[model samples]
Structure formats: structure tokens, C-alpha cells
Target: MNTWRQTSPTGRALLVTVLLTGLTTFMFLPLLAVHLSSEGVPAGRVGFLVGLLAFCSQGFSLLCGLVVDRFGTRAVLASGFGLRIAGYALLGAGTASATAVAGIAAIGIGGSLLGLAVKTRLVAEDGVPARDMLALRSTFVNIGVIAGPALGALVYPLGFGWILAACILSHLLLAIRLTLRPA
Candidate 1:
């Protein structure tokens, strides 16, 4: 059975977005320590950077919820994706520790904003029960959790830059997708 056929157009779009987000997040996160360490970052700093990124993504959801309330999902989703794109670019292009930290933080903040907006959009939809939508969302996330590491393993050898590039491009494509489809 194809989930795509079962889902409405908006659900399809949102679900794909969730899958890609999971892919992007898991791919970058698992490999980030290696990337940083290869660049000669100390192990302690690497842990701190990873922790900080986690904090921004998870810790700021309440604030992101407020922002979503003020701005609406479309704007916030686009802005969050933009931040992620820029963050990856910075993480790839710059060698300075400060630049890396900034990039990681931007990615986290973007994830925070994007995650809340998607959830908001889901709950606001009239057709699907929020519980069903969220359950499906969780399913998509689990798929990404599996796939991201596989993709990362295949590509990381080419360079961590490849993973970063994939994340940037995936987010860019998804942003364009939502803009066109307006889910």
C-alpha cells in the first residue's frame, strides 16, 4: 500500500518534508564530531558544539512556537530553511571555530522553527485528525532515522562536505516545494 495514495496533497508534502528533515538532521549530527575532529577541534569542544546544537533545536521549541504564532507557518518554515542553508554553507566554507559554532547554532535554530511550524500546520489542517497526522509524522521520522545514516556512510568518505551539500540542497528543494505547493 502506498502511503502517498492514502495521503492528501498537503499531507504528502508535509510528510516528505519531515522525512527530509530527519535525513538532514541525522546525517549531519552523527558525522559532525568526526568532521570537527578532523579539522583539529578538541574532543571537549566537539561535545560542547554538539550539545549546543541539540539545545538550540530542542530547547527553543517553546520560543519557536511563539514565533510561529506571530508569523505563521509558511513564513517561518521558509525562514528556517533559509537559516539551515546558510548554516551549512558556513560550516563547510569556514575553518574558524567561531564560524563552525555559529553554523551549528543556526542549523539548530532553523530546525526548531521548522519543526514547530510543521506541527502547527498539521494540527491546523481540517481534514486529518491531528493524532493521525502526528503518528504518520513519527513514521516518516523513523524512516529518516534509518536512511540518513546509510546515506551518510556512503557519502562521508567523499568528504563531510558532501553531507553538508546534500543537507543544503535538500532543504532548498523542500523550501521550493512548499512554496510552490503551499502546504
Candidate 2:
């Protein structure tokens, strides 16, 4: 166990997790509306797709909380990012509604699991002073929420496909960061 007696693993993990969360948020939410719009999906349908992410993520969060202890953070993080990669690929291809929904659900599940793993590991490693870790993580998530939409808007001018590619790069970076640090 990497104790938090000296340099706080919780704080460090929180910082990294925040960045990862930002990347994750950037991966899906920001591009969702734009992606759907580009596909000529009805605005109402776009709204439903966006809403599905939150609903699906809620369920996934519950499941992730249950299994995170056994799976470990590394595995969860890797798998989550992998799902995001697949989700982006499917979205980029403009798959059928059923296929897109399945992919979105996968994204929600993977993202939630990754989040739980990060939180659990930070709590375990940081111990009592986990508040700072939690706060930092929350802040990062908020930042992601703010940045994602703005980033999404840029996709129109640059190219919709570029958004998917960028997300893939972000996920790769996230995986690298988690693997190198092992926390």
C-alpha cells in the first residue's frame, strides 16, 4: 500500500484523475450534439441521445461501485478508455440508432467504472485526507463539463471526424498516464 504519510497519493491521484475526467468528458459529451446534428438526426432525437448518456451512466456508476474493489483501478481505467474509443468509432461511422445507443451505453458504463476506480484508489492510497482529493476531482469534472462543449463547437469548423480522432488521442494519453503512474 502506498501510504499517504509523506507525499499524498490521494492528491496526486486526484490531480491525474481530474485530467483524465476532463479527457473523458471531452471524449463524448461535447461532440454528442454536434455529431448527431451532422448526421441529420432530428434535434429531438439528439436531445434523447444526450439524455441517455446521463441515464445510462447512472446505472453504470452503481455497477462500477460494486466491482471496483475486485477489478482494480488500472483495469477499470483501461477498459473504460477502450470503450470510449469504440464509442467514438461507432459514432463517427454514423451507425443505426440501435447501434449508437448500444455504443453510448458502453461509453457510460466504461466511464462510470473508470471514475469509480479512480475514486476508490485515491481514497485507499490517500487515506483520511481524501477530501482534498475528492474536491480536486470534482473541480476537474466541472472543468471538463465546461470545456467539452466549447471544444465540441470547434469541431464544426475543423471537421466532425477530427473530434473522434482527438478523443482517441486523449484516451491514449489517459491510458499512458494511468499505466505509467499505476495509481
RMSD to the true structure for each prediction, in A, is 1.7, 3.8
- The clash count of every prediction, one per candidate, is 0, 0
lDDT of 1 by residue, 20-112 (tens): 989977888899998899999889998989998999889988699789889888999998999999889999986487898889889999999
In model 1, what is the error at residue 163, expressed in angstroms?
0.4
**Model 2 lDDT per residue over 1-183, tens place:** 222333365456555656656755674576678668877888888888888888878877877865766777778877887887777777777757987787777777767877787777666652455665566567778877777767767664777778677777777776677756654
Predicted structure 2, TM vs. truth? 0.80
Model 1 spans with C-alpha error above 4 angstroms: 1-6, 180-183
TM-scores for candidates 1 onward, in order: 0.93, 0.80
Model 1 TM: 0.93
Off by over 4 Å in 2: 1-14, 23-31, 180-183
